[model samples]
Each structure stands twice: as structure tokens, then as C-alpha cells.
Target: MTDNENLKTTPLDSLHRELGGKMVPFAGYAMPVQYPAGILKEHAQTRTQAGLFDVSHMGQARLTGADPATAFETLVPGDIAGLGAGRMRYTMFTNEAGGILDDLMATNMGDHLFLVVNAACKEADFAHIESGLGDRARLEILTDRALLALQGPAAATVLARFAFAAATMPFMSAAEMDIGGISCLVTRSGYTGEDGYEISIPAAEAEKIARLLLAEVEVAPVGLGARDSLRLEAGLCLYGSDIDTQTTPVEAGLTWAIGKRRREEGGFPGADVIIGQIRGGVSRKRVGILPEGRAPARAHTEITDADGSVIGEVTSGGFGPTIERPIAMGYVAVGSSLPGTRVNLVVRGKALPGAVVRMPFVEQRYYRG
Candidate 1:
């Protein structure tokens, strides 16, 4: 176990303690796993109202240079050059073997492309970006900023109270705005599968802005535990678990993230292998698994066929509070990947009944408008 003394703290660390949050080490940062409200209530709060998340641990950086987008396109599969100013796209950094290094959000910030990378992989990801782009793009790691997520059905309504422009921002759009007198870069996107905004604020002002948002009636402080459950129910991929150095985007069910132009042109790393997988198909693919019983199938739980042949293992799983059932996701053979395909989840030497199902066990309520 990681020692708490060695862990880093977010700008909202003191505030989390004041709210009785149980701080746990996550990606080297001391993040709140749950508050006095607990994970269940936090989950419900975000689903029904707004949950403020201190996601300051996430890595924020900027890529700037002449034709940075086109230069960046050489590293990832996404259509970076086509990303209009203020628009963001979900993408991944793939290795030469066509496996994901890290999943990230890239936004064309007009002058430079802003990137938000997974905290655990941020160091290596930035290094990879710097090595790949060389002089073509200048990487500026934003150490002075902190990120906060305001998520749920009432996110827009709550955020609008501070930044009126947030109410009208379309999904996947970003803008520089002032919220309650603090400058921030706000993006209408989140991992929770809800209409929300991710605000990038100066580290010095994060706690103040967080307090301002939490003071509202509809907003509450949410910890990481609920955030994980929320994203799991949304069927979103967790970087290291659901995808890794060996999982290709095609096999991970993220082929759509690879732009059509990149597919046809074939310039990015491992383009040959990924494009081939696109046309010829892969041996195994990621799929949603619904266990029949209330007992949740957890990570590394063996998935088997009727005859008890091991097919795959669950990568992410747990009780989904919103759906009020045990939900999971993992990779299985193509033959067993379809929805409604009966399977078994081996837990503690017992084979539990399950079935392959389509993802987003709960509908994603992203504010597309």
C-alpha cells in the first residue's frame, strides 16, 4: 500500500478534509474516495443533481507550433487537423504495436491544442508526445493549473449561475470564460456520461471556485468512488484496466475514434496493423457483461463458456447504483461478443451465470445541443 505521507494533494485537499472526505491515494495524489455522504449517495446525487469533482490531478498540457494539429495527427489516429477551434475530441496515443499508451481529450484551442491526459500515464504520455513530435510541436506542461468537473443532469443549470455561457455551450466544446471573477477554461465534457463541464482553473483559485460552485443548492462535493461507478455505468473505458499497451482501439471497441481520413491515409504509428484489424477484424473484442446475480463480478474474474473454457477476464466491474444491478465489462472472443450471449462468471470457484450485453448500461445523457 502507498503511504499517505508520500502522496501528493490537490488544491482542494484542505476543503475535502473539511467536508469529511476519506482521502485515498490515486495516481500519486491523495484524492477523496468518498465523503460523509458516501459513495451510494454521491452516485445518486450526481445522477439526479450536480456533483463537483476535484479532478486537479489530471494532467493538462498544450501543444503549440506551426501546423501543430497536422504534426499531432502523426502520433494519434484522431483527425486533429479537422478539429475546429473550441471543439474537442476523444483520442488515444497508440504505440508501434497498435496498442494504446493512454486515452486523452484533445481540444483545438485556436492558437494551440490543449490536451488532458490520464494522471497515471501523464508523465510517460508527455514524454511520448515530446519524443514523437520533436521540434514540430512544443509541449508545455501546465503545472500551474487545476481541473474540476461539475457533472450530472443539473450540471448546466448549476454552472450557468456562475458562467452564463456554460448553459449554451454545445457538448464537446471548450471556451475561455470568467466564472465568479476567476478566469477558467471550461469544456462541456466529462467521463460521467452526463451533461457537464470540466473547468481548468489556476491552482491558486481552484478551492475558491470549488467552494463557490458547492455553495449552490444543486451541487455537492463528490469523491472518486462515485466517479468510478458513474463512468463504469456509462460503459466508458478506464485507461489502464479496460485498455493498455496490448489492446488495440479496434479490439477495445473504439474504432470510431480513428478518423476516416486517418484510416485511408495511413500515417500514424501502427496504422498498418490497426487498419488491417479494421478491415480483417480482430480475434477478441471488448463487450459489456451483465451478471445474473447481485454479487458483482470484479476485475480479473474469469469469464467462461458453458463447458467452463476460459474466454476472457472481467477488467472493470462492480454494483452499478444507478441501474441497481451488478454490471461489468471485459474482452471475449468474437464468437462470444454479441449482446445476449449467455456466459459464466467464475467467482471464488463458483461459476455464476451471465450474458454479454451492449454498453452504456445507462443511456448517456450528454448535452449534444
Candidate 2:
């Protein structure tokens, strides 16, 4: 058997198979890449209704100490200390050179901090946190948990029937709750641009909760393929694809994540370099692209100027199910990052007309209250 054949399986592996899911290797785990409904339908379903995703492969960890906020601030640039209890903040794990190691979500669960990181980079993220915080904080990896995301315009309505507490939770907030008598940590946040919630429950109870959520008329099981296209349409970055260790937050258009206090206080790793970029600007920036033809521009496709000179490359590209056209995102020179700047995408050795456009080819439907 290949090394990937020996990959781990989530608690819902058998359930996925029972649902006619097509399984594939992802982040050292065998996960459902798509269901029989296919990526196109699944993508549209999520935009119109609710879609349930098994994101248990993600890493969940906790940091505890006399003052966990102080320990966390040493590594990340987010305003953790100012974040109220039961609130979540999106932040980045930055290197000393201002490059991003990973992008993650941090939630204050009153006594300790709850963190969810990318599945592929969990080991590096954990080691980095441990070495930086050391004796000041204790790191606990919760490998026994399973994560599920219910996302769409009707997500809140569907989840409201199962858990009353979820109905009251505000955006970017979280709380400990029981779903069908199983204890779980529920957060009003997700990777999709739409308003959604991520529920972290016991591994053994994962299937039960998933089945319950799927039982709802508006909910369907969506897989990785649709998940990627949905996030791309929302203009969210995919780790390793859109942003990586070589990309800085400023270059990725995530400068708003660095709070004013954190930027001026200058205590976190990479503060100098990142702050410098905030003032001096970076060489290139991540922008959205609208291709001319119906043919989708896949990743690594060359981006060129009006005169057909190579300027940059596409990082994430595909057919947008919602827009019904080809769209993409990539890093281009700072001077060519304007919304109306004309550009060309070299596809099959031909330069196709394109233009720099505002991101989120589809409008975001986040529930803000």
C-alpha cells in the first residue's frame, strides 16, 4: 500500500461511504472529496441553502497559563488580550521576516484559549507555539474531536432547531453547548464567506450530529471540491495555495487583521517587517481576476500586461459556479493591482483578455448583528 493509503480516517469515514461520497487523501487523512451530487451542484447548494462539511481533519488545540493572552501575543499579531470571552478573532502565525506561517482562528473560551489551525500545518504550528510560549503556557492538542461546518443563508435557521444557544450566538462568537445531548464547542464562524457555524464535538458523536444536521431539508453534505470553489468565490485564501510561508499579510490584503495597538506596540514576531510593509508597501499584492473566455484559468497560469509581457501568475483559478464565468486570484505587481487595470491571462499559449476586479466574485452573505 502507498503511504497515503495508510492515512488516518475521521470518525465519519464509514458514514461518508454510505452516502456515496468519493474519498481521497487530504492532509494525511482519507476524506470525501465530493459526493454524487458533484462539485457544481454542491457549490450552488451552499450558496442557496445549507451545506454540511466534515472538517474534523483540522487541528484543535488549547493554550492555558497564568495569562494565556500574554503567551499567545508573543507569536501572533491579533488583539487577543482585547478579545472578549466567547469571542473569536482571525489571525496569522507570522515569521520573523513578516511571512505567514499559517492563518488560524483564536477563540477566548473564558479560562483558556481555543485555536483551530490548518490540518497540513498543525505540527509546525504546535511546535512553534510550544517553543515560543514554553513554560508560560500549556499546549493541549484535542485529537479526539470532530469538526462540522453548516454554512449558507439558512444555516442559522437549520441549526436553531437543534441547539437554541446557536441561534443567539453573534457573529465571530462561540460557546459550549449540547447538541442532541452531546457536548460540543460551537462557533459562529467558518471558512466560507457566507454566515455559518463550526461545531466541534466528540469524535464518537460526530456521525450522530452530522446525520441530524443533514436530516434538515435545507442541509446537504458537501465535500472538499465544492468547499474549495465556494471559498474561492468568497475570496477567502486557501493555505498553501493562495497564501504560504513566503507571503506576508500585507501582500495578501489582510492588513486589517493587524490591530493598531499591536502594530504600534511592536512585540510579536515579524512586527518590524510587517509594520514596515504597512507603511512602505509591499512589491506585489493578491488580487481577483475576471478572465475573458469561458475556459477556466487553472492555477500557475501566467498573468501578463496589456502588451503581453509576463507580470504574475494565478494562485487560485476555476469556473465560478455562481458567476457562471471563469474567475481567478493571484499576486500581481503593486502598480497593476487597481480594480480596473487591464491584464491578460496566458491560457494554452494564448493571451486572453482579463481585468483586475474587486474580490468576492459572488457577494458575501455573512450574518452580521
**Candidate closest to the true structure, highest lDDT:** 1
Stretches of candidate 2 off by over 4 Å are: 1-4
Q: Report the C-alpha displacement of residue 307, candidate 2, in angstroms.
A: 1.8
Residue 100's lDDT in candidate 1? 93
Q: Cα lDDT of all candidates, in order?
A: 0.95, 0.92
Cα lDDT tens digits, model 2, 1-113, are 34656889999999999999989999999899899999999988899999999999999999998999878998998999989999999998999988899999999998999
Per-model TM-score on C-alpha atoms: 0.99, 0.98
1-369 in candidate 1: lDDT tens per residue?
A: 557999989899999999999999999999999999999999999999999999999999999999889999988999999999999999999988999999999999999999999999999999999999999999999988999999999999988888898999999999999998988999999989889999999999999999999999999999999999999999999999999998999999999999999999979988989999999999999999999998999999999998899999899999999999999999999999989999999999999999999999989999977
The 10 consecutive residues of candidate 1 with the worst lDDT sum are 1-10
Q: State residue 367's C-alpha deviation in candidate 1, in Å.
A: 0.5
Residue 15 alpha-carbon offset, candidate 2, angstroms: 0.7
